[model samples]
Target chain A: MVVDIAPMIVLGMVILTSLAFDFTNGFHDTANAMATSIATGALKPKAAVSLSAILNLVGAFLSVEVALTVTNSVIKIQDSTGAPNPALTADGGSALLLIVLSGLIGAILWNLLTWLLGLPSSSSHALFGGLIGATIAGLGFSAVKWVGTGAKLDGVVGKVILPALLSPVIASLVAMTGTWLIYRITKTVAEKFRNDGFRWGQIGSASLISLAHGMNDAQKTMGIITLALIASGQWHDLTAVPLWVKGACAMAIAMGTYIGGWRIIRTLGKGLVEIDSPQGLAADSASAATIIVSSHLGFALSTTHVATGSIIGTGLGRKGASVRWGVALRMLVAWLITLPSAALVAALTWGIGHLVGGLAGAFVVFAILLVAAGYMLWHSRKNPVGHHNVTDEWEASPEGLAPELPKEVVR
Target chain B: MSQILLALQAAGQVLLAAVILGAGLPAMFSLGMRALAYGNGGSAEVEVEAQPHVLGKVLAYICFGVVIIAVMLGISWIVGTGMGYKLSFEHFLPVFRKK
Candidate 1:
């Protein structure tokens, strides 16, 4: 019974950490769905987030292809080498639980850090990176299916990395063309006329994008929790996601969305581009299409990248509007770092958790996670970004160079 | 590299489809606005905020109707396939699956 108790406790901790990761994912990506609508005043900030939250709840029921991809791609649930199992696995199911717990811990911290910096990195990649890092620390390179099954490159490279590169490009192209066409077609119309009509269109497109986001992102948490169940010896196969799991994940994400990630919204909506109604509509349309289509293709593309790219594309499509390459460069750097940084943290947490042993180790790491999260929360208070002040003027360096920066680089 | 090519091909399909539906819907809405200008079949100089001509109003409704249908199809596709039993396909969109 004592032997069973430790694994049970670790499993419970893993569930909670997975939920925490889902919560961060909620707030982090809300901007992907609603930022443009809010920026253009098509939807009030509170109403925008509230609508996104409800749609995300409805969207969670959309599909399981991504979840299946995550489970099969990231970690080997059962070894097939015909060799003796490790002592940890042989002793009990605790080893798998520990890996997942450490991975979720890593993902949650990365989510918090990126959220603090207001950088909209890929939460999907963060989650995958955490799992990969923890698997590496726990089991070695052989455990990860790098080249994928049957000598094809359809695993992480096919699903996560390649899609990451292509999604933003596709979104940008679509958005740019959309913006140019909208402008050209409506050039004869009054500015107020076109702008007013597009505002209502922007709301619809933004809502669809939010629904698409829910369909894509909430599935990640579901996959991780399913992994937990399998690793804990509760579920035997990578099967259908149970109903209760779906409800819990959907609710967690909706709650988080309602809370809203105002800082990141400010970054995407205001900092990246001074979005007009048409640009907002174009961006949202691009995001909805890219996300929906990518998920349909079984690729876990980050909605953040798509939204950012669409915003940039709109700026480029319009005459005399400048893309803030400095901010864009910063965002790119953050995206590059997201996977490895999350992995490093996951690895360290995994090592620390094991060194102390059993439930106590998981508890210690959870406490550390709470402290790290709390500190980030407090640190953000100093900057104080919210719906009220999210539309304030963008300072290129946050240092406010006093009206000299725009002529410094922009055309 | 072949895997990369395969992924690229799928991306091309996504781009095309997105353009037709994603970008196209907003363009339809724009066209709807434009069509509303000729409700009286006069010059296309009617102010957008002004009252619309009946024929132009019907044309606007047709454009919006196409947009609504597209959105509904997208949702049903998500719902039918996402619940994991209504449809199955080896790639992208799905073919009907019984049970």
Candidate 2:
């Protein structure tokens, strides 16, 4: 009885933590799809998030492919067919459960910290980073799939690092060309007429991005939860995610989208460039195309990186518009550190959990995550960036990198 | 080194596809809008005394039709992939195949 209850408690923590990561993934990425639309007044602040939320829910249901092998790219916990390694499944899978829990804590903490800082870091990278860190702590470094075997692009370098380096540059070039072409094509059209036409274009392209986000991002969480279930010997199927897991993930992400990450939206929208409707359309179309094409080609890329690159590219394409290099540089720095920072945190969490041992260790890790998350939430309240002030005029700060913090609202 | 080479090949493919669909589609949309402005004339264009042209309207509709078709293809691609089908082109005609 004691043995059974310990695994159950650990399994419960894994499910909850995976859901929490999914929620963050949703809000963290809302800006990727809707920031340009909101920035250009193509959609109202509240309406943009609401539409994205609905589209995300629909997109979540659209994914029929089993992403159960998601962990194969970064770590060696699962075999090629998405089955948990039998060695790790010992002691009712308590070992696998602890690594997953600590990794999730690392991811969540990094995500919340970035959110509070108004930085648009990749949630996927954070997740990979956390997992990699915890895996190093739990298993030896040899267990990590650093590079793919043969000619295949399979491991961390191929899937994560290479894509991170290249996707943005590709997206930027595509967007720059699109922006320049649109401006050249519509040079004779009246500005007001051009803006009106592209507003509809922006909304359409943005919706495509939201749908893609739901289809792709939701699968990652579903994969994690299903892996947890399989490890604990509760689920047997290695191909299909449980329906309840799918539904719960869909709801969590949609709810996060509706809540909106206004701070990141403001930064991507106003901080990167003074986006007009035509540029918004160009940027979003570029993002939508890059994401779709990459995923189709099986060269997975982060939506956030593509979107940011597109926005900056638009700034470069426009004749007089200038990109805030300072802001762009800061974002670049954030991206560089996201993987390592999350890894460090996760490694630390795993160390602490390993020290305490068993169910108590899992609880200790969970408590630390709760405390860190609560503190970040409290810190964010100090300079809240909500729908009310999300699109306030961009003021360059002397300190640099930090967008001007929203002015305190007196009730 | 093989991984780097493979990643580059994939990146090149993505960039090519992205330019055609992402950049090219928006340019087509802009062209449609430009043609519409020519068709409407008057306040739609920078020229104050321009006349609406019937040919411009026809051209505008043609451009918009192509864009609508592309968007439809995109939607179908999303739906088909969700259902575990891959969108492929055989002799320039889009076909769905079981993946």
Task: Report the lDDT of model 1 for residue A7.
Answer: 73
DockQ of each: 0.45, 0.89
Q: Write down the worst ten-residue block by lDDT for model 2 chain A.
A: A402-411
**Candidate 1 lDDT over residue span A282-301, tens digit each:** 88888888778776765557
TM-score on alpha carbons, each prediction: 0.89, 0.96
What TM-scores result for chain A when each predicted structure is judged separately against the true chain A?
Answer: 0.91, 0.96
* Model 2 ranges off by over 4 Å: A1-3, A396-411, B88-95
What CAPRI-style quality would you assign to candidate 2? high
What is the i-RMS of every prediction? Answer: 3.2, 0.7
lDDT of each: 0.77, 0.92
Residue-wise C-alpha lDDT for candidate 2, range B27-92, written one tens digit per residue: 999999999999999999999689999888899889989988999899899989999898899868
Residue A86 lDDT, candidate 2, scale 0-100: 94
Q: Provide C-alpha RMSD values for all models, in order.
A: 4.7, 3.4
